[model samples]
Target: MDLNTAADAHALTPLLNCLLREVAEPAAEHGEGTHRLRGSGRLLRVRGGRRPARPELRRADGWHPLSHSELVELTSGELRRYTGVSNDELPVDMADSRATVAALLAARAQAAPPRDPYLLSEQSLVMGHPHHPAPKARGGAPAASWLPYAPEAYARFPLVFLALREDQVAEEGGPSAATAIDSLADALDGPRPPAGYRLLPAHPWQLELVGARRAVREAFADGRLLRLGGSRLPAWPTASIRTLYVPDPAADLFVKFSLDVRITNDVRRLWRHDLLTLRRTDAAAEEGFAALRRTGSDAAWLADRGYRTAGFAFEELAVLVRDGLHAHVLPGATPLLAAALAEGEPGSPLARTADPAGWWRRYLRQVVPPVLELFARHGVVLEAHLQNTLVAFDASGMPVQALFRDAEGVKLLRDLDRPAAWQRLVYCLVVNHLMEIGGALAERHPDVSPFVWPAVREEFLRYDAARGLPETAELLAASSLPAKANLLLRWTRADGAAARYLPLPNPLRD
Candidate 1:
C-alpha cells in the first residue's frame, strides 16, 4: 500500500473499532464486516482481518468509501450524535495522527530497523491502540518537531544533561536503587558540573518543549540549573515515547521523562501525584512479582526505582529510573513487547514457530498466573495491558517468561476494594492484553483459532480450580467485560486518567 492508503488504513482501524464497539447497536447483525450505525441510522462495511480497513458507508446512491479524513468526520459526527457533545479538538488530533504515520513510514524507509528483537518490538506500533481514536497522534505538533524523536521511526537521541543545584534536586526511593541514578550521571560522557550540582538527564524533546518557559529559563539564569550538553551515546525511545531504554550495561536502565505533549489520552508526563506515590506502588508490585517467582514462575516486575528533578520545574524536568530487562528476563530468552506481538509485526522473530498450540499455552502459563496471583494474593492491580507486558521467548520460540513494568499505573488495595480491583484486572488482563494477542495468534494460525478462547477459558478454569478464587468464579459467571471507552472519552474531551468503561461481550463459558 502507498503512504496515504497505508496511513489511512492505519488510522482508521481504531476509529472504526470505536464506532463498532461503542456507537453501533449490538443487536444489529454484523453480516461479514458490515454494521449499522446506532444513532445515525447509517450502514457501514469493512473487510479486513485484525486491523479493519477499507471502510464503506451506504447511501441512496450506493456504497461510499471513507478515507481516513472521511472516517474522522464520520466518527466526529457519530460521536456528536451519540454523546451530544461537539469535540472539535479530536478531529484535528485524528488528522495529525494519520500525518504522523506517513512521516514515520517515510523516516523508517531510510532508517535501519534495530537488530535486537526487543528494540524492534518496542518501535513496531505503527498502528497502536486498536481501540483508541488517533492513537498515534503526537499532540498536533509539526511532523518536523516530533518525527526525529518518534519510536516508530527508530529514533535514538542522546539525553540532554541538566545539572541541578544539589540543594534544589528533589528525589525519593531506596538508597541502593537510587544510587544507580548518580552512577548513570557519573558514567555518561557529559560535561561535569561544579561540585555542588547533581546530574539530571532530560529527554531532548522535552527540553525543547519546556526550555522556553519562564521558570526554566530563570532557573538557568540564576544557578539552580545548568546546561551541560548531551550524553555521548543515544538511547532508543520505547513504545511509550517518554521512556527510553539505554543499551549500555553500565547505564542499562529504562529512563522515563515528563513530556508536555499529549499522546493518546494524556500529556505524557511523570505527574507529581504519581511521583509522590511511586515508592509505595513500586514496592507493592515488586512484592507481588517476588512471590510469583518463589512459585517457580519467572515472572518479574520492572520497578520504577527512583526519580530526580528540579524543584522549580518538577513536573516538566522530572525523570524516573526503572529496572532494566537484562536482570529480569530468563537466560537465552528474548523479551518482546506484548503490544507489538498483538500488532502482528511481520519481522518478529516468532516466524519460526510452527507449534502455535504449545506456544500459546506456554504464553498463557507465563502471563496469566502471575497477574491473577498479584491481584488475589498481593492486592496489587497491575496495569498489565499490552504495552506494560513483555513475553520473553526461548531459543525454540516458545514463551519462557513474562515481565511487567510501569509502577505508576498500579492501583493499590487501599484505594480500591476487591470487586473493583478484580474488575479492572479482568479488563486489563483478559480484554485489553490477551484478546488482542490471541487475535493476532488466531490470524496467524487460523487452523487453531477455535482453540484460542477455549484455552483462555481453560486457563481461568484451571486457575479457579487450583486456587479456589471467588473472583474467577464470578468472572466465569459474568456475562460481559469492561473495555475502556477511549473513543467516547476523547469525544467528550475527558482526562486520560479519568477513564470510562463500557460493557463488552465476554467469551468465557461456565
Candidate 2:
C-alpha cells in the first residue's frame, strides 16, 4: 500500500498528472493541476478535481477488476485473514474415499496421456465459424460445411471453488460414517455449522481431471498436491473459493468457475497444454502447405492471424444442477472482465487499461504476421501468448477475435521433419507459457519496467526480417529464455499484470 502512503495514490495525482500530461507528457507543463506536501510536516493535501462518479451500480461488465476486498487491503491483512480447509473432507461415502483413492494413484504415477492428444475424430470444433465459404467457381455449388460446433453446446464448468472445514465434522468422521453422523448432524450435514465444514459446488474441471492433479503436480521438492487446496481447495479464510457463474444449458454461454486452484484446474491444464501445441502446429502447417502444392502455399501464410482452435474433453466439463434454457454452470468472459475492473474509476477512462504498446500491436497485428506468414509460406511455428491467446473484442473497441489454444504450443521447421512435434512445441510455448508467466510478471510489476522486454526481442527480429523466417538470428537468440522468464514471472503471479485485460491507449486517444 506504499505508493508513499496511498490515499488513492494521493487522490489521483492531481487529475492523474494532468491526464498523464494529456496522454504522455510532451515535455510537461500542464499547470492548474495541484499537489503539495512539505517536510516532516503534515501538509499533505492533493486534488484531482473533486472526483466521485464510480458506482455504475458497482460495475462488472466483461470483467478484470480483481479487488478481492481490495486485494485484502492490498496484500497482507493478516496474510489475507486465514480461512482454510476443505479437500471436500470426504467420507460422505464411496467406500470411504481412501484419501481420494490414494491421491488418484499418486497422480497417475507422474503423467502419461499424450499420443492422439485430442483431434477428436479429425478437425471440427471451430465454434460459430466462417473462415471461408464462397468457393463454387470450380464448376459451381460446393461450399458451406464447417459451421456446426459443439463441446456439449458451447461448454462451461471450468471452475467454481469453495470447501472448508476443521476438526468438527463431528470430530472428523472415522469409524463408518461416524455413528450415523453423530445422530443426524442436523438432518445429514446442513445447519448451525462453522468451526468446520462448508464445501460449495466444486469442479475446476473436476479438480483437474479428478479431485486433484493440483493441475499437474510439478514437484518443487516431493509433491502430490499438498496444501493450498491440497491438490485443489484449501488455504482457508471461511473456506473461500468464490468464482461461480454457471449457465450454458446449450449455448449463449457463460461458466466462470474458480475459487482459485490457480484459476481452476490449473488454468485448465494450462489450456490443455496449449491445445496440444496448436495441434502439432496445425499439422506441421499442413505438411508445409502440401509441399507447395503447385507453389502457392497458404496455411494462412503460416498461421496466427486471429488464430482459433478448440477441442476439450475431460467429459465435456461436467458438474450440473439445473437452470432451464441450457445452463452447464454458466458465467465467464473473465467474470465479466473481473466485474468491470472492480467497479472502475481508479482514474477511469472506462478503466480497462493495459500497456506495452497494445501488447505489441496485437502481437504484431494478430500474432506476428501470422507466424511470419507461417514461416515464409509454409514452414510453421505459431505459439502466440496469453495462455495461447484468446482476446476477442467488438462493439467498436476493435480486436475482433483470436482464439489459438494449445497443441502443446505449435512449432515445425527443422526442415519440417517434425522432431517429436518440435519438442512438444518447445516445452509448451517456451517452457510453459513464456517462462512461467513471464517470471510472474517480472516479479510483480517492478513499476512496469520490463520495457516490453527488448521490445519483444525486437518484434521477433522484425518478424524474421519481414517474413523470411528460420534461424532468424538463431530464433531471435533462442527466444530470450522464455522471453526473460515471462518478463520476470508475470510480476509475482497472483494474476496481476495489473490484473490482465490488456490493450490500452484509447483513453480517448490523444
Candidate 3:
C-alpha cells in the first residue's frame, strides 16, 4: 500500500514517464520520492511492475496499476483474448509455498501510442438506436398533455423518455402525449428487445421509481421525456406510467428536470439565489456562491475554461453528456449499495474490512481534498451522499474517478435567512458522509472505540487544521459567514472529548 518510495521507482518510472509524455507535462515532478501524485485529468497515477520482472512505481495519467485482486478480476479474460494464451501461459509465483498468479506484462517503455489508431469517426459507434425513422404524417395537430400534479418522490430529477410499441401507430392513443406515459406501464405485445440487443438490469433505486405508477405518469405528462419515433421507442421506454425508464442498454446521458415547483416548495426548498448562481455559465462567477461544493466549483471552473459541460442544465432539466467527467461509469458507480454496506453484501466495493481499507482510504484521499477545495471557491455545497456521488473506474476495476449529480441537493449558504454555512458543511461532510461509513467501520472493529461520531468530527477538525487552518480562522473572523459551522469545529476539537452519545444502534452488527 506504501506506493511512495525509491524502492518502487524502478517499477514506476516506465509508466510515469510515458504518462508525462502523453500529458505533455514536461515539468511534472516526482515529489519526495513518495509524495501523493497530483493532476487534473482522469489518468491519475500509473505504476506497476514492468514485465513482472523489474517492478516499477510511477504516477502519470490517472490510470494507476490495478491491485492484484482487481487485476485478476478485470484483465484476466482480456489478457487471454489479446495474448491468445490459455490459463497455463499465465505466470504463477510460489511465495511461501502459496501459488499466486503473476503475469509479466511487457512494460512499454514508451507509453503505448493511444491503443487503437482509428479515426475518431471510425472508432465511435452510433450509440442508442442506429436508425430512427421520422414520424408518419397521419394524425391531426398533436393533442397537448400536462401532468395534473407532481409527485413528492421526484426529489432526484430523472431524465425520462416517451415510447410506443412498434405496432402502435403514430396517431394511436398511446402516441398522444397523455397516453404516451401510460404505455410504459403497459407491456409491448409486439415489441421485443431486438437481436443482439441486451437488457441492462435496473438498480434497486431505479426499480423503485419504475414500480411507482403515479410518479411515472406525472413525469411523462410534464414533458420531461425525450421523444423518439417508432424505432427510437425501443431504446427509450417511457410508455408505461407505472415504470420509470432505466436508460440501460441505452446511452450514458441521463436527463433530470427541475421545475419551478422543486424550488418553490417550503419543504425541500430550493432558493432562487441558488438558481441564479447555478444559472451563471461563467466559472469565474463561482467566487460569489458560498454554498457551492468544492467539486461543483471545480466543475464551474472547468466549464469556464472552455471545457464542455460534459453535463449542463436547460430549465429544470439537467443533461449528462457522457463526455469528459462522465467518460468512465463503473459497476459500483453510485454509493447506494455502499449505503447498505453494514448489511452483508461482499459484492459491493465500499464494504471496508480491516484487511481491505485501501479502497476507502484512496477514495477519501482523492475525494475529500477536492471537495474542500470546491467548497472554498464556491460557497455552494454538493450533497455527495451515497446516491449523488458516482465512482468511475478505469480499464481495470480500480476506482479512478468520481461523478456527482443531484443539482437540487446542492445548497447555497448565503441564500438562507441566516446561512449556517459551517453547520451545513459539518452536517453534510461529517455527520452525513463520514459518520455513515464510520459507524459501519466501528461496527466491524469494536476495538476502535474512539472512532465515534465525535471522534470523527475531531479528526475532521484536525484535517482542517492541517489543510484549511488559515481559511478556518479567516472564516471565523468573517461575520458574514455562519458561526455554527465554526463553533462545531472548535467545540469538537476543544471540548468534544466529554461529548456524550445518545443511544445509537450498532451500524454493522445489526
lDDT of 1 by residue, 1-510 (tens): 788788887888988888888888533374677888876988898878567788889889988998989888888888888888898899999999899988898899899988888999999999999998889998888899998899999989888887899999899986855686776675467578779998888898999999999999999999889988877778999999999998788878999999988899998888999999999999999988878878887899998998988888889999999988888888899999999988888845444479888888888998998888887788899999999999998887899888999999999988987778877888899999988988888888888798888899889888878876777777877888898999888888788888788988787755
Best-first order by lDDT: 1, 3, 2
- lDDT of model 3 at position 152: 12
Tens-place lDDT digits, model 3, residues 172-290: 11122222223332332334434332112121223232324554445446533323322233222111111122233323232222222101111121223443444332232334322
RMSD list, candidates in order: 1.4, 24.4, 22.6
User: Can you rank all candidates by TM-score, best first?
Assistant: 1, 3, 2
Better of 2 and 3 by lDDT: 3
For the record, the alpha-carbon RMSD of candidate 3 to the native fold, in angstroms, is 22.6
Per-residue CA lDDT of candidate 2, range 412-510, in tens? Answer: 566346543333344334333333233333333444445534544566567667665564455444423211122112222333222222112211111
Score every model by TM-score: 0.97, 0.22, 0.37
Identify the leading candidate in terms of TM-score.
1
Candidate 1 Cα outliers beyond 4 Å, as residue runs: 26-31, 347-351
- For each candidate, the alpha-carbon lDDT, in order, equals 0.86, 0.28, 0.30
lDDT of 2 at 429: 42
Tell how far residue 144 is off in model 1, in angstroms: 1.0
